[model samples]
Target: MSTGGKVQWINPHMMRAQNFTIRFVKPSRHMPGIVALREIRKYQKSTVTLIQKFPFQRLVKEIAQNLKEEFRFQSSAVDAL
Candidate 1:
């Protein structure tokens, strides 16, 4: 899926001007990390809009436990995200 716009540079050094797209790879049962990464990337893209309309603390409380158990994410890591 594409974000469908020019990349906004939060920091000049963080990204290039080249076009970017996210493509799905074939799923593998054994790679939970890859699955988590994909899900996080999807969330990262929408985070700005999501946070504006939703209560972030509520959302985090709802999903934090699941993220920790399913992906083996530490509390600090989930908080950082």
Candidate 2:
């Protein structure tokens, strides 16, 4: 099930696959793939420059934008206005 905002709650019983209609239980705290990727973007530093390749710059910028959006960070000097 999805809370449909910044959060989601996976049904743990679904993992077992033993019961299709198991009684509904509290949602698990674990995050899904998108959330994990967003979190990585939010906190991790860029290692792309160290790659020493022409393709890496684009990758770095893309990653930076992802990080910025995840944390709602301002991206430009004009953001102050």
Best TM-score goes to which candidate? 1
Query: Against the hidden reference, what TM-scores do the models get?
Result: 0.25, 0.20
Which candidate gets the maximum lDDT versus the true structure? 1
Tell me the lDDT of model 2 at 68. 82
How many Å off is the CA of 10 in candidate 1? 53
Clashes of each: 0, 0
| lDDT for each residue of candidate 1 in 2-40, tens digit (9 for 90 to 100) | 444435334433334444444334432445588789989
- Tens-digit lDDT track of model 2 for 1-81: 554344444465784576555353454555568788976896677644335443555555567687685433233522222
Model 1, poorest ten-residue lDDT window? 6-15
